[model samples]
Every structure is written in structure tokens, then in C-alpha cells.
Target: MTFQKISILFACLFALNTFSQFQVDADVRARFEYRHGFGNLFPDNTDPAAFVTQRTRLNVNYKLEKLTVLMSFQDVSTWGDTKQLAIGDNNNSFSMFQGWVQYAFAPTWAVKLGRQVISYDNQRIFGGLDWAMQGRFHDAALLKYKNKNFIADFGFAFSQESQRNENTDFLLQGAFTYKSMQYAYLKKTYNKGLVSFLFLNTGFQDFTDANNTIVDGVNYRQTTGTFFKFPINTINFEGNAYYQSGKATATKDLSAYNLALEAIYKPNNTVFGLGFEVLSGTDQNGSSKNKSFFPLYGTNHKFNGFMDYFYVGNHANNVGLNDLYAKAVFKTGEKSTLLTKVHYFAANNTLINNADTYLGTELDLVYSKNLLKDVSMNIGYSHMFASNSMSLIKSGRSNNNTNNWAWVQLIVKPTLFSNSK
Candidate 1:
């Protein structure tokens, strides 16, 4: 079946090129950041860090009657990190960011394969993670079906280290990467509301025993969730609920959950909103089962404050988070906007030695403006007012230290070539 699909796709591609559409585009983004306590509490007597990073990408897309193909190449690097007169780069930061092909066999059915991005809904479970200089991609295959107001997608992925004639032992290492993954997503759309359901199963290679010996097997984990959005007049409400279970390791049993709700009111050119979220956590003392909830592949930096103090490559399998936030957005000019948000943070589980649960409060401000048709700029600042309890989990640093971060970013995207144009 796979061979037949590929053959049909190529045949269509060759026959329809004369009447097909092809396009080329580019994206360039540069960001400068000043970090005093970006991801953690600032310790006393430590100098703040400043740096600039950039991501440049070239994208090619081709579309025929029933087939489509896309390829993207990108280079991500930091300024002042390479030698001016070097013959070549040692880091090899250039890579194929995405290469995918899709073929629609029926009016409402299609199959897509290759390296691609899997993001849906609010991105609380899976996301593209475009904020990172090196964005995320998955090598997988998907089967999609869609009708008037209903859609369904089934995805599968498997990984291996290399071709070996002897055994199927995968030693490829990563903190959150899975050896195998399968998922199903379904969505229903109404007049002004939508609801979606997702079920994902991920398997990890288990290679170590209790005594640190070699074992060959796989441990599986499961995540199930639902997301919904509804609008009533000028107020919109959105929420999500998710649960995680199964084995996190060879010997550990997992049990965790996440819940969130938000309401937004957009009257005229101004917007206001309020939100609350909870992620289950393990007890500080100890427990027979694990309870900490991790968002896995979500765009976590977009949540829990832009400062990324939680769930951005840190804070896993520990005390979970409870966040209550309020935000407002104002149109400052014809092409400019300003946003302000405040978050009150706390713990979802009991703290060690009966410590306080109140972690800290954060304030974030962002200003954005469009300079040209394809150019835009953004400036942001965030401050964390830490409490004594926050010091307990964040390296025991002094809460009195000034904890703040600031950044500026510029983005430009242009269409280099288009057949239709």
C-alpha cells in the first residue's frame, strides 16, 4: 500500500506540474535577550547575561490536483559564537527543518508522511514550539478524514538508532523523546463553538534494570484529553482537561492530570481575559506512585508566564503548579498593540516541612508594532516578585534579589517566488 501511494503521488506530481502551483518563501527572526532570572530565581552576586540568537528559514511548497509537497531548511545560531575567519562551522547548525508529502486518495481522505509538525487546539499537549530557535519536528505518518463539520486524524511514529542484523535495541537517548508513538484526534465544529478529543500513547525504551544492568523492552505511557471553546455574544470561554497514566519508568507507576479554564471578552478594539490552571504534582515527602504532570511536547513558554519559570525544560516530576492570571490588550495605534498580564502562582501539592504554598507573582508587559508589510518588532519585560516559598524549590536562592527579564525581537517574512503571482 505504501509503495502504491508513493508511486501515485510521484505520477501526479510529474503530470500536473504544468498546471500546478509552486512557491518559495523565507523567514528571518532575530532576538536579543537580557536575563537576570529568566527560568529560575536570581542568586545573589551573579551578573546578568545578555545574548542574541537568530533563525533563518527557506520554505518551498508545491501543490498539484491531489498531491502536495513541502520542504523547509533552516539555520539557527547565536551571534559572536563563530570565528570571523573560520573555514567552516563546527556546530553544524544548518538542517532540514521540515520535509513532507501528502496525497489525497478520496474526496475526504488523505495520507501524509515525513518530518512534520503536529499541533492542535490550544497547544497544551502538542505544539510546533516555534519560539525556540530550533523548532520541533516529528518523523511520522498520518491518516486524515474530514467532512462538513467533523474531522479525524490518526498518527503513528517509530524510531530506531541504526540498522542492526542482530537485535532491536534502541539506545537513542533523550529526556522526553519516545521510541514509538500513536495517537487519534477527533474534532467537531458547530456554528460558533468547537470541541476536540485526543488520545496519545507513547512508548520509551527500557534498557536498565534495578541493579543498572541491561534490559531490553519498552514502557508505555498514555494521555487522554479534551478541549472545547464556545462564544456567547462578546464573551468567549475555553477550557481543557487532561489525564496521564501508565509507567514513566520500568518500575515507576504514573498518575497525573491537568485542568485549565479561561474567559475572554473582546469589546471594540480592547480585550480582557481571566484564566486558571492546575497541574497535579507529587507530594514533597515521598509517595509510592508518581503524580507530577508534564505537558510533554506543548508550547509551554506561551503559558505559565512568558518568563518560562515553569515547564520549559525544567520542573518535571516535582511539585506541580497552580496559576491564576488576568490580562488585557489595548490597541495603541493603527499598527501597534500593547499587552499586560499578571499571574499569581502557587503549589498544587503539599510542600516540604509544611512550607507555604504561595510561590510568587509575575507581571508581564509586551509592545508590538508592524513596521512594514513583511516586517514586525516586539519588546517585552517580565518581573517576578518572589515569596519565601519560591526560594525553597528554586535552588534556595535569596528572594530579595531583583528578578526580571527583558527582550526585543524582530521578524521578517517574504514570499520570494509564486507561480500565481
Candidate 2:
């Protein structure tokens, strides 16, 4: 809450370690938002939701010749929501955000173990969801390889509710959750552009049988994709294509894909972007199988407009989406920048009930400025204009009211301790 308290906390963390190379850092973010139409559509009668959220983090790193270790603790909460709880209570409403260790056996091979975040090229399928108050992390193991122009990484994980308990049969905590997962990513850099390939496999736990009896089964899906980026003169081009197959949780056949391309031009201090993206949709009238593409664990908010009107969890197996958008960023000064984006959204497939393909349009505006060496401020506003098809998709959900959102956020990351020597 104050600089003195933060310093004391850092000192306490340092007291626990006696390493040759150690560093401690602190990160704090506070955001106030007014959501007339946040994640969901608003009804005409219901009032908009408004709140302030904050995240505080402290991280420590210790490195040696053969091993490297990191530990980060975080607290995420809404403003004025904890008045009923006592401080330091064992209620223990906290997270050990990240705890991991990496060991290098050779120059090109290393393994990292523990709970950490996974982010990849374009973050189209896997990402660190930093926008959320409690960010995303995975308990897994990763094997890494690095070289001059090539790199490869493989990750494996299995989620379970009880560990080392013989009575439990390795059951994952929640329904529709992955019981086990694995992925392999490889990348190669070329003279003109860089290309990367990814292969991810996920298995979900089965909980029921034909007779509605409890059972343990496995349903699996695999995702494969490639991402590329290159530069031509002042214009930079980028694109990606991904496909998914295998069976879904219900053992239904699954087939899906996503394709996107973008070109960015930066001349002087101003930048411009043009992009198009499409996700395949299921054919409701034709088959009993599912075909809608899910981005899996990617940062969906970065796409489909910041308003998060599409695929943020609302349209998983329904009609897919098509997005055509453009944006411009103007660097106002050395420390300030402004960005504006416009998007046109449509359904990827014709609706079985109504042949409507038109979804809606959205506009987003953002401004950011640095106030101190370690502090920055950001403000944003977004509005979505829904169509009749949107009403049909959101059927009985949204309040048929105006949809808009506004927010202001501040980020502070400070290096509490470091030994440059």
C-alpha cells in the first residue's frame, strides 16, 4: 500500500535467500472501469456494472551456473471488496502466482518444472492472460532447445484434483477441463521472415457412462498451426493458420480451423494496420458433429475488438466469426501515444434459423502515457453496435440496451533489488 511497506516486504524476501545472483522486483497495477456493456450484452432495464480492480505482485529470481529459480506472489482484488475479512487471516485468499525452476544440462537442452505461463508466437493458441485480475498459469514441465536460428520447446501437463491419494483415480478438478495436455513448438528464422510451427494435444477426463454411471475416460484433441512474419519495405506482413481435429469431450467428432492475415505500415512516428480473420463455424442443419473453432487458450481479448463481444466464451460451439478491421496509432510525443481501431464483424456461416450473416461493428480508442520512469497510464473506450443476428445469438441474454465501456489503468513496475555486479 505504501513505498515503505513494499520495501519492508522486499527485505523480508531477501532475508530468505543467500545467493550470488539474486534480484527482486515489484509490479502493481490499478484500473478503474465503467462498463455499460462489458463482457455481456446489457438489457434496457439493468444498470451498468462499474468497478475498480488491482493487482500487486512481487517476484524474486536467483540464478547460478547450473540452475535458475524464480518465485512470484500476487494479490488480485476489487476495490473495497475485502472489508469483511480481517488482515492476515488464514482464510488465505492469495495465490503463489508463479513458482518454477530451470536446470540446464547442456548448451542446447534445458528443462523447467513447476507452475508457469506459456506464451507463443502471435499468442493465437496459448498465452498469458494478463488482462484478467488472476492471470493464467499451468502446472507442467517444459523441455527447451535453443540455437542460432532454430529453437524448439515441448510441454507436458496433467491436471488432477488429488495428488498422492490412492483413493482418487487421477480426476481433474472441473468438468470440461483438460485431464492431460502436451505440445511441441519449433521455429526457424529466415533471411526475410521467420516461421514457426506448433503442435498441441489435449485430453479431457470422462465422468459418465451410457447408463449414467461414474467412470474415467479420455477424449482428446490436437491442434496444429504455423505463424509467419516478414517485412517488405516499410510494410510488415504477418499471417497464421491453425487447424484442430480429434474428438471432443462428448466423443463427438470435431473439426475446426482459424485463418488470419495482417499488414502493418509504419512511416515516421505514425503506424497503420489492416487485417482480416475468420474462424470456421459448425453446420447446424447438416450434421450432428461439432465444427466450430476455438482459439483454445489464447488471448482472445486482443482480437475481436477489446469490447470482447465475440468468442470470449459466449460463442464456443455456435456460429463462427469473421472480422475485418483497421487501426492507426499516432505517437503524440516521446512519451505519449494514441490509437484508434474500427472493426466489422460477421458470422462465418449462415444461421440455420435465419440466414443472417451480419453481426455488428465496433470502435475502440486508447491512449497511453508515461508519467515516471517506472510508471505508465492508459485509458480506453469501446462501443459495439450489434445487429439482429447478434440478438438471435445472444437470445434472451442481452438487455437490448446501448453497449459501451470505459476504463483507465495505471501500471508500476519497480526493481526493488538487484546486484549488477
Candidate 3:
């Protein structure tokens, strides 16, 4: 059957259930963005100028007693002289990003089935990928339970490949969380603080040619991490560490690790934060390899300072990274706020023997305002500067030192209803 038929069938089924505990909610968002590149920063630049694009999202959720269903659809388009050159035609049209059903078996036990999002502790190993206009969703089943201060979760993902691979894969993950703030030294006084541990395993199944022959060996990856949050006065300390070992579909086995630390100080409407991260890389096991790292649960757009040059999962393996980030937020009034951020990133390993490894710097600014009681709008801009050692920005044999890029985005959101207990 077609997707529309399936959707209509589900809706009819829900309508037939005579339950007073049923509830429905919906949300929609629209965004317009403009991007410009200069000095050979982006590939295939005939005029090398600016462009505009638009995106719209609609989400519907239905709940009946302990069962909940969710679906999201998005539409994307571009315009202007450089629209085709900058945004590409592949992004045009509408698509479903997620569809899932969740069942709750008491306050502490729940299971989500169907195409859902599998986000775990710190998102170092698994995430929903919500930064993009059309975010990532998983086709999987997840089970979760929480008893008092302890929580456990497990998930299984099947029949898919990520942007970097061609093989269908499966993912298994387990995570645990301890919510007693008094047990950890850093979290003793913070009632809402938590400590979590996660383990993720990904394996490829039947990754072979159409003739039922194996072209590359089955791939496997294991990731383990611990994350904690501590609050002191108006400042909060957050940290995470992860170790990963994996072999790509056609590559040798590799091992890597990551470390992240941040301090967020929020005193009323104004907030200031700073963070540092490191990814380790060395010649281990007789292979000159690069260490892997995930930015974890942090908002990629907010942390990497909007230029989206690194840590967005675009350039993952070739270079290790060390990043320093800072942000400041100011409340302009009761209904408006202004935010700005800066990021400095450098390569942890040498791109070449003689080349320096400083990656680039980024600057971002955003303004948000509440236009009405339940309506809001946001505007943002970002700029990036490329260094001589940044291989991703290089063209031919010359380092594109003059390369730079900028983006602007506007968003509008209106809420329908909210319930408070």
C-alpha cells in the first residue's frame, strides 16, 4: 500500500477507538535562509555569490492513554541567481522525516516502536541529528525503564546506511543513568544533575553484492562514554569522555577517544558559557590513523559557532580536532533576547609534515523575539574564516586563505496549546 493509504488507515483506527483519554497536538515551523561564499570556499562556484533558501516543517502528535504517535514532514526550496549553485536541486520538495509510536507501560517502563529517534546519553554515540532542515531519524525499536533514581534503555536499528556508507547496517545500544546528585562530588548540591553511562554497538548485516557475495567484510563499531553535569551557584560544569573502536566497511580497524568540558553560567536572562574539546590521534597498532570524536549532546549550531565547518559529521575521519568555544546571551527586554558566539578550532594532528594545523575561526549572532502571546521569531547570522592548513577549504595546490562564508536565517513558530500540572 502507499504511504497515504497507510496514514489514512492509522487515522481511521485511532478515530474508531472510543477513549476519552485521547489527545492530539500539532506544530508547524517555517524558515528562510541566505548563504554566501567567497574566494573558492565552496565547490562549483561560477559567480561565487549569495543565495536564498526556504524550509517548512509540520509535526503531528496523537496520544491515547499510554500510547503516543508522532509524524513530521518538511518542505524545502531555494531561489535567486545563485540558488541552484548554492543549495542544489536535490533538496527540493517535501518528505517525511519521522513517524513513530510509543507505548508507556507505567511511569517507569516504556517502549517506542517504528521509525523513531534513538538518542542516548550525551548523543556521543546516537542522536536525532536535529540541526539540519531535514534532520535524521532511525528506523528502529527502543525500550526504556526508569526506577526512582536509576534508568536503563536499549535500542535496535536495522536496514539503513549513513551518508558515508553504502552498506545496510544494524545498531544496538544500551545506556544507564544515575540521578542521585549527592552521589557524585561535582553534582552534590545540584538537585537536577545526572550522571550517565552509555554503550553502543553498530554492525553491518548482509552487506554484500546483489549476487549474494561479500564485497567488503562486515563492519563493526563499539562506543562507550560517561557524562556528568554539576551545578555551582549560577554556573554549571558539564563533561563527557568516550572511547571508540571500529572498522569501516572497507577499511582497517581503528581506535579513537574524545574528551569534552564546559562551564555554563546563567544568572537570570543573561548567560555566558565556555567549552573545550580534544580528540586524540596517534600511530597505534602500526597504523597512522586519526582519532574519532562526536560533539555529543551539545547543540552543534550553538557550539561550533554557526559556520558549520566542523563537528557537523561532514568531515569525520581525515583530521582530529581541538576546539574552544564561548557564547554570551543578553536579554534585550521581556520579550526579546540577543545571543552571540565565537569558536576556535585547530587540527590535533598534522595534515602534512610542514603545514601548520590551525583550522579556522567562526562567529555567530542571533536575535529572538516573541511577537505575540504564543508566536515567536528568530534571526541568525554566521561567518567563517579559513586558515592555510585547512585542507577542506583548499583548491588545487594553493591554500585558500581568503576563503570565507556567511549565512542568515529567519524562523517563525506559533504554539497551539500547553498543559501544566
Candidate 4:
């Protein structure tokens, strides 16, 4: 059906339904960044880069007795990318970030379909990467069940380039997105802690030929993990363990693992935490099987370091990482706070010639303040101190250069309309 016709039908349904709720909201954010070495080590004789990026979103939500709907329109662009008087945007930045519908068939069972955000326990494997200008989403369907202390979800998806009468080859151009995916998640809650389990299966097209031709049907991989959080007095302990197996490519086999543990202590207005994490890596000398563990479709920026030296679209399938970090959050004022974090990084596998395992150390600081009821501001800075081994992994880049990044961001979220029965 046409979009206009569907809108009219929804309008009619809204009018006929007496017991319903509707709401509209907006999220506008702009950030300015100064990057000297933001994703990678800085090269010599190169100037720093600075730019501003913005993301604007409009969300409409509706709810009835057994149905819920959400439509989120988003636009993301860098400042000065478009002319002031341009008839249209230079690049197509407008898109439907999320358009989903849910229907509850039973008291504790429901199904959701369409483009939506799928995030789970600590966002280890699935997350809504809201830190990026254009967040991540999935076009899939989910079967959901929730009760007093138990929850479960089953998800499935398939991707194709376009409508074609030929073979079913997913040649969608862009990054290496999955060809198909399926997952199941279960969680049980208790008085003091909760534990969750996730089992994911993802498939990729076998593009083995030099010309990017599809050879085999598909190669599949599996990820199984568990996450748990428990509290003891004023301290909380959380951890996760995950393993990956199956085919990484048409030829290479995948075998990897990730383990993490964290402890947090909250006292009064201050929070302190210490964490240790390790992702299995492949040997530098080379191996027939791939052992690097990649955390697919997760908020990786929240880990490692704010400088994004690992994962955030880079450092995949290479020497994996070992990150030991500590963080502190302090309430500076009634409406302001400060956060500081330090990370010590190393290679999980033997480096070339078995070089030093210590990669580098990073320091991150962020200050946040609430300006108004629905407005907030944040400023952050990060510095990276690299070692010789870090230079080896980063393509022999000079680690002697000073590496730092800074950013300032402003966010405004406002409720435009709301009607509840």
C-alpha cells in the first residue's frame, strides 16, 4: 500500500480507538570534534582535523490495548556539507531510523517486526549505538515473552540487495553486513542479581572470487554467551563470557573467546569501578584458523577507550585486545558531573617476533551539565600514549607524535505532544 494511504488508515484507526495513547518527541544533537589521533595513531607532518556533526530525530509513538507502534525519522550530517540555499541536501542523510510495530497475542507474549533496536545485557553483542551520528538498527522480527522474573526473545532477519529475478545473492554494497541472522536470548531475575544467556547465529555470503563473485551459498558463525550482575553490600560485580565458532570465511575457520569481569563501588555521590577484559586474538605468525574475536553489532566505543583505537569499525580480525581499566564518576554539582577513565591495553596474542605485549595506555575525561529541563551539554577529552608494539600493529605509524582528541556536544530532547487516557 502507498504511504499516504497507510497514514490515513492509521489516522482512522486512532480516531476509532478510544483507549489509546499517543506521543511525539524530538532529539537534536550537535557535536564538535578536534581529532589529532581519533581512531588511529597520528602521522608525522599531518595537521589535526576538526568538524561538527549533527543528528536530528523525530519520534512518534502510539499505543493501544494490545498494540504499540513507533516511527523515528532521523537526519545526520556534518556541518557545512550542504549549501545554505541548496534545493535539497547534498547527500541523502534522511532516513527512518526505526519503524516498528508490536502486537501482544497473549498476556506475556508479544511479537515485534520491522526496523528496530535490539539491545541486551550490557550490550555485549547487540546494542543501539547511539554514540554515533547515525545509530545502528536491524530489519527483523522478534518473538518476545516477559513475566514477573523471566524474559525471552527470539529474533530473525534476512537481507538482500534489491528485488531481483535471478539468484539470491546478498550483494548489498557498503560495509560487511550480515546476509542473515538469528538469535535467542533468555534472562532470569532474582532478588539481588540477574543472569542472561544469548545464542546468535549469523550468515555471510561466500564472496571468495577475486572479482567479488558469490561462490558458495553462505558461511555461518555462532556466538554463545552469558552475562550476570550481582550485588554485595555497596559493591556490584558483573561479568560476561562468550565464545565464537564456525566459519569466518569460505576457507578459514573461526574459533575465539571473550571474557570480562568488573567491580563497582558506589558511595554517596561518587562511583568507582575496575574492569578487566580480554578478547582472543590470532597468532601473528599466521594460522590456518582464525582466532580473533570480533564483537559484532555492539557499542564498542563504550569499551577500550574513548579514542576508539579498537573496534568502532577498525581493528577487526587482527591481534585482539586485552584491556584493563578503571573509572570514576563524581557528582561535581547539583546539575553537573565529571567522569574519568584510564585503560591499559595490550595484545592478546604474540606480536610479530614476539614483541612487547603492552600496547598503550589511554586517559579519558568527560564533564556533563544539565542546562535546562530538556537540554544538556558534555565536553570530553582523551589522550593516548602508545608503545613500540602499538606502532607495529598500526602499520608502522610513528607513535612519537602526541595523540589526543577533544569534543563538545549539546543535546536537546523535548516532548512535543502527548495524550494519555
Query: Lowest summed lDDT over 10 consecutive residues: which window, candidate 1?
Result: 1-10
Rank order (by lDDT, best first):
4, 1, 2, 3
How close is every model to the real structure, measured as TM-score?
0.93, 0.92, 0.76, 0.95
For candidate 2, list the clashing residue pairs, or say none. 42-399, 43-399
- TM-score of predicted model 1? 0.93
Residue 35 in candidate 1, Cα distance off native in Å: 0.6
lDDT of 3 by residue, 1-421 (tens): 2466458746854563444333333334455554454323444433445656565665556567787777766665555423444533343366666788899988888988776665654555456666556665666677777676677777665553345445433332111111110111111223768888776666643335655344444556566778888788778888888787765333556578888899999888789989998875442123444365544333454345466665554445546678898889999988998888887978766565546668777777788888776566778766667676665424332344344454445555544333321
Cα lDDT, model 3, residue 166: 56
> What's the C-alpha lDDT at position 255 in model 1?
96
Clash tally, candidates in order: 0, 2, 0, 0
Candidate 3 clashing pairs, residues 3+ apart or interchain: none
When 1 and 2 are scored with lDDT, the better candidate is 1
**Cα deviation of 273, candidate 3, in Å:** 1.3
**Highest TM-score among the candidates is held by which one?**
4
- C-alpha positional error of residue 117 in candidate 2 after TM-score superposition, expressed in Å: 0.8
* 181-236: candidate 4 lDDT, tens digit per residue: 99999999999999999999999888767777656679999999999999988899
- lDDT-wise, the better of 2 and 3 is 2
- TM-score ranking, high to low: 4, 1, 2, 3
